[model samples]
Target chain A: MEGSQYRGYGMILLGAVVSITIIRLAYVLYWIGRPLRPMPKHLSTLIVLGSGGHTAEMLRLVNVLQKDRFVPRFYIAAGTDNMSLQKARVLEDSLLENKGIGNKDIEKLAYFEQIYRSREVGQSYITSIYTTILAIVHALWLMLKFRPEVIICNGPGTCIPICLVAFILKVIGVRWSSIFYIESIARVRRLSLSGLLLYKLHLADQFYVQWPQLQRKYPRAHYVGCVM
Target chain B: MEMSGRHQSPKTENQMVFVTVGSTFFDALVKSVDSQQVKDELRKRGYTNLLIQMGRGFSIPSKSSGEDGSLAVDYFTFSPSIADYMRSASLIISHAGSGSIFETLRLGKPLIVVANEDLMDNHQIELAEVLADKKHLFCATPQTLHQTIRTMDLGSLLPYPPGEALPIAKLMNRSQNRARSSRSLLSPPRHFCSNNSPFFFVDVGFTVQQGRTGDSFLGISFSGCVLLLHTARPRLWILLLHLFQYISS
Candidate 1:
């Protein structure tokens, strides 16, 4: 009787383990295909601006967005990029002027932050690993504090850490930081390094490409037709 | 009367030719455009001014200003308003950066894009080639820039349509409509906090400095792991309990 009872307990344990595994898999699948939940009246947006062409392209996209909807915009740039932040400020000023928003409302509506670059232009790979981790930690801090609903970025090294943290938030059921990745117009034939990482890893919810060749090459990416 | 009027006019027009390498150094582009052959080509095309915005490049053109027979040449390290120069110029020769190329294109100025071969991955060339194929601009390497300048016909170029972001905006609106519920893990603590901005008080400097110490680094990582575990417990337990009931049944 004791032996049979032990066998019964063991069978129950095995069944429990198997069922848990199957259920967990099913939950994940459901999460992936989960229907859109109703959003708040206004979304908190985080815009990651890169240097030069990346900034120009991203700002052009930002310029077209309805300001009233994506309120309390948070702009993040690489710490070393002096010009990009200045450019963003210019854009913000223009936006403020166009809308005739008062100076007192600036702090509430728009905030600017900078995150350290994971790797500089010439940094070696060994050192880059350490810096990249630091960047992720920094990005995590920012994401937690801001808790933005939307994260938009074009191809930039800085975007990698920020987007990675946002992806983690989604997976761990922390926040639904919907990531929008727009490939640069300069990339006609192939995706840039950042674009390739986000595309292959499925980090971005909506990946847009300007050139059809790139879209054909990466079937999952949407062809948006020359957004610059 | 047209031939006599042309003869009566000054030999050189007040037209300017702007050459830029964008934000980074492109010594080859600056050096190539500085050559007497290229200057003579520009002067022959009725351009009397050649302005070069050579960014971080050590190569300054041999001619500083206009000499007796040569066009007026000027050089600057960088400029705040490059568009101003593009607006005034009859012709523009710029590095194959999408910013400068599109800026020039949007202004309806003729452009010759010189692709920097040294850039790794060299995606700039593809944009240049595509634009050239569309007859929107001319494309050339540093070696062929002089030839491109000599042969490029400004009239043959077509104007690029004004860029539109309406489609992207629409897609983004749709995505926002489909966003997940706000009661996720991070939302509760934010609501609990008194201040509008919760979790804003962090000593980033001290935390970053702790990375150098082996013990502290481990401690931080451990704490981070623990935090993740604590927060994810609710969802984890619910799923496990549901599965356990299903299995027994």
Candidate 2:
């Protein structure tokens, strides 16, 4: 009798779990029906940052953003050695070969935003300080020239440091800001120093994490399933 | 999908061709032949509406191949020509580079992204894997390249999954619909919560830091364009109670 009772409990638990999944799926479908409200057809342009696999993800996001009336411009941030900028440019060539995207085809701009580091151990502090100041200058350029409503970091590279400058700008006067992650969010500990930096900069404006395991570390991070 | 080596006639509307000669991982030998092989195969399979751009770092050098007996391909040394082709393609075949992925997806065009491991630490292979996992692209290996194209069906692979699409669409739509939108940055979130919800409805901002200095400039000798950085800032938003209740019950 006890065995049978235990079996019944197990069956009940499994049924509950299954039902919840179905219902949640239904709610998600419903919510999606609201239609993704588009941002202003323009913002300083949603420049996508990337190095390799991540670069593709960011670029794809840029494409999706472009479909709507409010399409953002494309920009690539150079990584570590600021080398990503040149590598990313190859992608533009790749665009020509595969997708057939031409520089003149869309109202877009492509350039590299290199990130620098100080050589001397002593210069590290000074490097950070200078980086901070340069970030501020770049922020001002973005604001004054291509003014974006919200900044979307598809690739983390320059996005992290730039976020600091943006943060400073926001504190002083800028109003809109946000940072998104294109990878999993189950564990913050595993995130690169840059990922952690971005996570902190936005402080919660909005994060589009890709996995559940990451949630344990980023309690506030939302699992959008996949941002690719 | 009628393809042509020659540009389509002007009367054609809603027409596009995919010219996917993926990136060559610094390969002088493989790249020399990849383009012509693709073009010939695609033509035989009735893919007449195709335009192609050879992979990156391959330029004026290949055209000279006509002088070589081993290099049977009529390679074009032209790199810039791809820009025109990109504008013409309704469908795109690309190497697994982030820029190609971004361009195609943003254009809302159908795509097939091939992997070129030689580019960066076999990163393209992994990149293709992630995109395939998300159902955003079609992919294949070199051995099966011809077969995949011969029996290609884009309808099934598209449209991208909603979870991914919704958030992106929301941002674009919000940007378009709101005339009040102006130059301003949204504040990073202050609270934290992790659950699958439509909260992706809000926008996630970006930052661009320039790494220019005596060291980076002297060490690298080039400015990096597409840098991948991370943000550890915590953004918190309330979870959809509906998900909790729905999952628990």
RMSD of candidates 1 onward, in order:
11.1, 20.9
Q: How accurately is candidate 2 docked according to DockQ?
A: 0.11
lDDT of 2 by residue, A37-126 (tens): 233333444454645545555655655554433334445364343434555566555654566676675436443454442121234665
Tens digit of lDDT per residue, candidate 1, span A91-133?
8888888889877788888899999899998899999999999
Tell me the tens digit of each residue's lDDT in model 1 across B41-160: 887777888999999999888665676867899889888988899888878999999999999899888889999999876888999999999999999998988788778777678888
Best by DockQ: 1
Q: Candidate 2, chain A: TM-score?
A: 0.57
Off by over 4 Å in 2: A1-152, A164-193, A200-205, A210-219, A224-228, B1-40, B48-51, B59-91, B105-110, B121-127, B133-136, B142-144, B150-156, B161-249
Q: Which candidate wins on lDDT?
A: 1
lDDT, candidates in the order shown: 0.77, 0.47
Error of 2 at B249 (Å): 58
Candidate 2 chain B lowest-lDDT run of ten: B217-226
Q: What is the Å distance of residue B109 in model 1 from its true position?
A: 0.9
